[model samples]
Target: MSPRNKNTMLVKLRNDSQWSSWTWQQKLRLHGKHGLTRFFPNIRRKVNEQYIKYIKSYKIEITPYLLSLIDYDSQGNPQKNDPIWKQVSHIDLLSNVKSADYNGVNLNWEMPEEIHYSILHHKYPDRAIIRLTDNCLGYCSYCYLAQRTLDKKRKTLSSSFQIKWNGTLEYLRKNRQIRDILLSGGDPLLFSNRRLDQLFKDIKDIESISTIRINTRALTFNPFRFDPELIRIFKKYGLTALEVHFAHPKEITQEVDDALSLMDDIGYRPIILWRSPLLKGINDSCGILEELLVKLYERRIVPYYLFHYAPYSPARSNLSTSVKKGVRLLSELRRKIPGIAFPRYTLFHSSGKHDIPLVQEGTNEFKYEILANKQYIVKFKNWKDNWVIYPDLQDN
Candidate 1:
């Protein structure tokens, strides 16, 4: 849908009494292809049988709140380049899967050796991530942890949290070197208030854990999830920061502003930070990113990291952009926005996270190599100072 029409629809939906009263769970009932077509009827014709089968295979979850943000054409079909739709919908999954295989892209990026139970301890010895739950209010098609989030044999929230708790706590206690703990999964915020409180209390008891950060898209997926109780839990345990994902400026709706206001009321605004992958047709333009970063800064949310899209599954290759393109965009952004509004351009490799150097007049920091098969790859120095080669997406 056109931006103007989208804004109009959003305004109308926000004022609807029914939409305003619905709980997060009710809003979440919009799941899979049936729910999608119910709202946007034209999608039924745009997507074929194969696409429907693929979506069901991986599963798709979209909240009414998020659905309201997507733009649709006059015919009620989602706009081809709609950022929110691109992130949540599985329309391009089959095609991207074919392209990824044709290009010989890696389907999985998780480092098996670095994983223990639900925790992933990579190059950073001082930090570790605990997968607290395997459910999310909504699912992003490009997520690197698709194996867990999209798994058919997914564990219940309670069981998943319980199973990981004991082992994760034991590991954290043994590793005094690890001071930072990131609570991630499908998203840690999906935990109920009581469960979240318990989680905070448990993690707080660890003497070695100095910082507790929650990686969540609650602000975007379902801002209503940030109620008074949730805010209290964050304050009670002293959450260092909330690493939020905001891929486009359009995502910063009034609801999101209201959620931020709640945090501001409690003086927790300083801890809100943003991070998102550079997706090809979504927020890849220099103007879009600048607007997104500026909007975030205006709301006191620090722009943390603009990541190079991880090619974790063949179905996500369409979203991936060349590291070169990402760095260039950041370099341009660096020139336009204030230093505080800028974020590091990073790439997550099996070894660790590495910041991609920006292109400059006389710098030769970026090292490129051509493989025997004529595929281009870039060499990066990992956190351990070991050189790692990564496939560079061929810019379209």
Candidate 2:
């Protein structure tokens, strides 16, 4: 839907009491004159039961603010280019997914391993990821979190807050070492403002968590989700900062700019996670990656990381962008742009903090480091301890 159409549609829906009361599923039917039928072009030939069911039930919602930025008429599915598509469509890619370790990321869920109660396993006691929401606004064809995040119906979000979600809160309270809560789930923004506001307040009460960074694509997937009211709620409850996951420059639309302006007005600071799944056909070029970083800097959003695509489900051919391509792009981007604008081109390697930087080793091998490994495997071991080699350090 075009931005104008989306806005017009939203206004129409809002005015209609019946529309406002409907579940997201119902809204899709109203979105276009046709409801379930709208998804037929994409799903008709496919045979994935979970996805077929999802598309059957899932609503197609693009807010006016976000839709306005899209070129709906020219493109076959303008929404596909929109970040909203990034969130919703990737689950289909799950059927074609593969493992991340052979390509670069050492994948594992702390689940049965159980160092802690998370899908995440961290090295330090001072920081850890706390997943509050179990829903994603869109399912990426190349989602790393597929094993944990999918299956929408069973995911817990109690209409009543104090009653059902209290157990999650109690779990966090017991783990005092977690100073930073890197909010992950499907996407934290998938939750309603009321649910999130209460959740943040409860976390703030814990006192151990100082910095709250949300690993989300809301800026891309649902930019409209971040409003003045949401920003106000975040600020009031001391939600420190936001991390917006914007992949390529194409993903950062004018609507995102407008939303950022709203956030700017409310004094909400954000760091842009300029990471890509590096999908083969999607965005594998050094130039595209560099342009994305440049645009991010132009918007004053910090370029954080260019992630190596996690090969999880469907297949590597469908999802994994070559490790060689990732490393080359990192080198070229670093040479072309300044350090800040250039994201730390890295890959998430496991339940551990290993973000392997795509770098050239002497024998034509590429290597990076595991941030914190169970055992010490130094990818970049500096010999600063050599006393005679650096004699100046003796007196200093």
TM-score of each: 0.89, 0.70
Root-mean-square deviation per candidate: 3.2, 9.2
Q: How do the residues 1-396 of candidate 2 rate in per-residue lDDT, one tens digit apiece?
A: 444344334445446544322133223431332422342334333433544454443323333333333443232233444433443344344343232322222333333453344334344567766565556654455556544554333335434435434654565677787788777776777767887787778778887767777777777656666767788887787665567776657678776888789877998655545455665555667777777778888888887666666534323445465555566667766779888887665544333333444554412122322333232112321223221100000000
Please give the TM-score that candidate 2 achieves against the real structure: 0.70
**What would the TM-score be for candidate 1 when compared with the true structure?**
0.89
Model 1 score (lDDT):
0.74
| lDDT for model 2 | 0.53
lDDT of 1 by residue, 1-396 (tens): 344354443455657776643263445445655666666555555474555676655657777678777776766566767889888876456464433332223434556677776555443688888877777878887777776676444445555657667777888888899999888887887767898898789888999889989999888888888887788778878889899999999899998888888887876643878999888899989999989999999988899988887655535567787777787778777889999999988887777777888863213445876778777678867677787777776654
Which regions in candidate 2 have their CA more than 4 angstroms from the true location? 1-26, 29-36, 39-110, 114-123, 151-168, 270-273, 362-396
